[model samples]
Every structure is written in C-alpha cells, then in structure tokens.
Target: MQADNVTRTFEDPMLLQRIPSAFLISAAVLVGMEVIGFLLLCEKHVYEITGFSVSESTWGEANEVPSKINDECAENAVMSNKEMTPLEALQTADFYLLWASVCCILVPQTMLSSLSKFFGLEYIRDDSFLAGITMASSVCNAVGRVIWGLLGDYLSFKVPLCCLLLVWTILLVTFPHLSGFEGSHLKALYSLWVCLMFFCLSGVFVFTPLASNALYGSRNMTINFGLVYSAFIIGGILAAVLTRIPQLHGQTFTQFTIGGMFCCVAFVLCLWLKDPKYPNKLKNLDVFFWFREYISLRCFHWSLGRYFRQCS
Candidate 1:
C-alpha cells in the first residue's frame, strides 16, 4: 500500500497538484525570510549585525588647513590617533577586513553551515532567524540545479531523494555536540552545527531544485521552472506580512523558536511531496542503448577507423 502510494504519487505529467501544494509551505517560509529581512532593515532600522563598517573618526586630517596651522592641535587631534583614516587607510583597512571576512567564509564554512543547517531545521522559526539561517544555508549549499539535472539523467529520483531527506533529518536531530576548542564552548557548538548543517542542507537545498526540474519537463521547462521559481520572490513579500504578527528582528527567542517549529513542520510537509506517480521513470530508460551511445561518443570515428585499418 505504501509503495503503491509512493509510486502513484510520482506520475502526473503536468499540473503538479499535490506535491506543489505541499511545497508551498516551504516556499512561503523561505521567501518570507527575505521579505521580512528587507522590511526590518527599511522600517525598524535594525541592522542584521553585519558589523562590517568604518567609523567617521577614521577619516584622515585635512592637511590643506595650512602648514602654519597649530602644530600642537594637529598632533593632538590627528597624530596622536594613528589608528586609521578614511582616505589614507581605507584601502589597506578594507583589504584586511575583506580578507578576514573571506577567511570566516571558508574556514568555518562547513562547520558554520552545519550550524545553520541544524539551526535552520531547529532554531530558525521567524523572519530574523530564517534570514540569518538562509544566508548561511545559501552559502554552503551545493547547487541543486546541476545535481538534479545529472540525477534526472541517472539515478532513481524517488528513492534517492527520499533516502537523502531521511538521512538529513536523522543526522540533524541526532548530531552530538563537538569538543570545545581549547576549552571554548563555542568550539563545541560550532562543530555540532556544521555536521548536521552539511547533512540537512545537502538533503533539502540540493533536492528541492531536482524536484523542481523533475516536475517540469525540458520542453516547457522554461515556463514550469519560472512559475515555481516565482515562489521565492513572492514568498519574500508574503513572508514579510506573515512574520509581522510577532515581528522579526525585534522578535524574541520565543517567537523565533516558534518559527523554527514551523520550519520543522514545513520539512514534514515535504514527506507528502511526490513526483507524479512514476518515481521509476529512470528505470524504463534505454540503459543498453545509452551505454552503447555513451561508448561510441568517446572515440566513435577514430576507433571505427582504427578497427577498419586493422581488418584491412
């Protein structure tokens, strides 16, 4: 019965009904984050904590004031504070800061990804949390479109996708804490976050795209993909409104916690997703035919000529 439903659910060639409906929940959640983030920045005046900016105090002195200017005043105001300047030190200061930011991006990327992945699944409940979490998820996630395209041509879509999501959820929920860094608790927390993040983001971030492509065929692929993709943009708009109930950036941990819970529910909703009643489409492909074609492409003309020469 279960197998039959799973198989039946994957068949429809068009009008992706059931699965599309369920996926909307996730779309709503993701898009909502963007909308809310934008609104928070615009209206509430609350920053996302980037902490990446320069101070006015770092501006260089206007040396054109004249050589006759008070030497004592110049020394007191500018010379004494050799920290940095907007013009003189901006480039160097920016370079190092950019370097450090890039370092943070790669160094703990996987670990931070795991943390975001885990946190996304566990903690990112509302706009703010989702915003931060998605920001992180977007960076570490494997590009789904490519993976799905290849998989569509190769693997059994249903089983592979389902197996992946299941594995991801299990890894996320069961991930254990890491050893603290030199007795630092953050080190432990960071480790736990990365592992689960890697697993979960890989599962969802990558699979959603494959699922998208799978539902829409290559012929009308453009339009189908477009409609689905719109979810992201509209979701941003709707999310802004929906999340305003409790507010996002100004929202507390409790509200954010609830948002995370909603995300979990959304993940659960993915289970209801099905590929159009034919999850086994790849099984019917002409494997032998493709294999013959595959080999021929490698050295079709040259190999044929070589064989002909040998025979002659």
Candidate 2:
C-alpha cells in the first residue's frame, strides 16, 4: 500500500479507480438517506389524511396545527431594517476569514468524531465501554451548546474562542499518548478526554450562526450562512485525506500535530477579529469593560446601533 514516490501515487491505476468508486458510494449513501427520510414523511402524511376520513374530530385538531406553524414561521419571515442582501455580505473580508476559521476547526473535529470509537477500542478493547462512552459524549455535546451560549452572553465571543482553541490544541497534542493507558483506568480517562474534546468542538456550530449575524447582518443570513457552511464540506474532505495518511506511510501523531497547528493558527486569527457591535476604538480595551457593556442589555443594543450608524 506504500507509494514509492509522489508521482507513483498519481500514476497508480487502482488507486485512481477507487477514488471515483468512493465518491460514487458516498453520494449514493447521502441520496439514500434523504430519499428514505422523505418517504417516511410522506407516509406519515398519508396516514394522517386517511385518518381524517375515519374521524372528523381528528382532522379538525390536525387542521389547527398548520395555522400555529404558520404563525411561528411568519415571525422569522418578516423583513427587518438590519437585513443585508446575500451579495453584499459575501463581499466583506470578514466572511472569508470566518469561513477559514471554521474550516480549520472542523478538520480535526471531524477526525475526532469519526476516530474516537476506534481510539477507545484500541486502548481499552471493550465494546460495551465504547458504546457507553459514545452515549455520554453525546450528552456532553448538548451541555456544551448551552454552556457556550451562556458564555457568549456573559462575556464576548472572542473570550470563548480563545479558550476553546487553547484547550483543543492541548487535547490534540496529548491525544496520541492515550495508548499507554490500560483497563478501567484507560476507559475512564479516555471517555473524559473525548467528551471534553467533543464539548470544545461543539462551540463552532453554536458560535458560527451567532457570529455570522453579528458580523454580516441578519438580512442575508440564509444565503450567507449557506455559503459559509460550504467550508464544512471542505473540512470533511481535508479530514478524509488526513485520516488516510496513516495507511499511506504517514504517522497518526504527525497528522494530529498538524490539526493542533491549525488550532493555533485559528487562535491567532480570532485575536485579529473586530466585534461588529463595538467601535474599533473599543476593540482593544479590557475584557472586563466589554462584559460590563454586554451585561447591560438595552445599553448594549443602543451602542451597537450607534456603531452601525458610524460605520454606515
């Protein structure tokens, strides 16, 4: 499976053939999932419709549901003064920078998600323990969303970003050493570490939308967010390639180190980011003052509006 040289990898006929097959298989799997989900929804609707003929009261109750949903949907559909066109949002430098930051974090985050189970088994060799650990990690992911949201409200996005990247970098560096542990101790330690890593990774999803609205404006959010999220697909591709390195004559530890380096770079990028809600003059001031302003809800909105006016 080892390539003699870089040219040999490109020249390998079988490897090239497998590339297309892999892509086809992945596409088929995605399409299958969507098709199955759509069919299930259709089946449910058909059942509901059939039931209406059997019971008018049931249909009456169901009919009221759509109006409630319309009311909920109407709230989001309303246009606001702050909304920007998608094209306008795309032209900003912040858009590209934000996209790149997300791409960086997601590469390793994808790796951890896919490989953690293998890593757990490699260390402890316990199937039951791995299953339990994965379930616990899912809970950690949910807790992380709530925790990071509150952190952003209490402080600023920058503080959470810095802390997350720093911790994530450290985790990546130390992850390769987990192979040395054994038995119940290893399971306990490995589960805790992986859960914490998952917690850190969850911040990107929670922060991205909030940060997008804050920086790019809410008007073109749907299109702008869609464009920004394309970085996630790019990250998945990078992670897929990186994960293969170990099988292709590269070391897993080195691949992980590369991921940690990306986090370091992301941390540096975060430091350069200016808050759209605050004037440039206030960007470099103390974090304590930033939190003070953030804690005052009405004052914060008023200041942000003034900042927008000054920029406009």
TM-score of each: 0.34, 0.62
> Candidate 1 lDDT, tens digit per residue, 146-232?
554456444424445545445544443443323223333543454445534553445443444444444433444445444444444
Best by TM-score: 2
- lDDT by candidate, in order shown: 0.43, 0.72
lDDT (Cα, 0-100) at 218 in candidate 2: 74
Which regions of candidate 1 are displaced past 4 Å?
Answer: 1-139, 143-185, 202-205, 242-256, 276-312
Q: After superposition, how far is residue 176 of candidate 1 from its true place, in Å?
A: 14
| Residue lDDT tens for model 2, 1-312 | 333343322456887779888899989999999999988784334333453344889888999886876432343334223566778777775677778888888777866786665555445655567778888888999999999998866454766877899999999878877778777777777887889998998887777887777666677777788888888898889877877775623454676777888887777666555455433344566464445456667787889999999999
In model 2, residue pairs whose N, Cα or C atoms come closer than 3 Å (at least 3 residues apart or on different chains), thus clashing, are: 83-219, 84-219
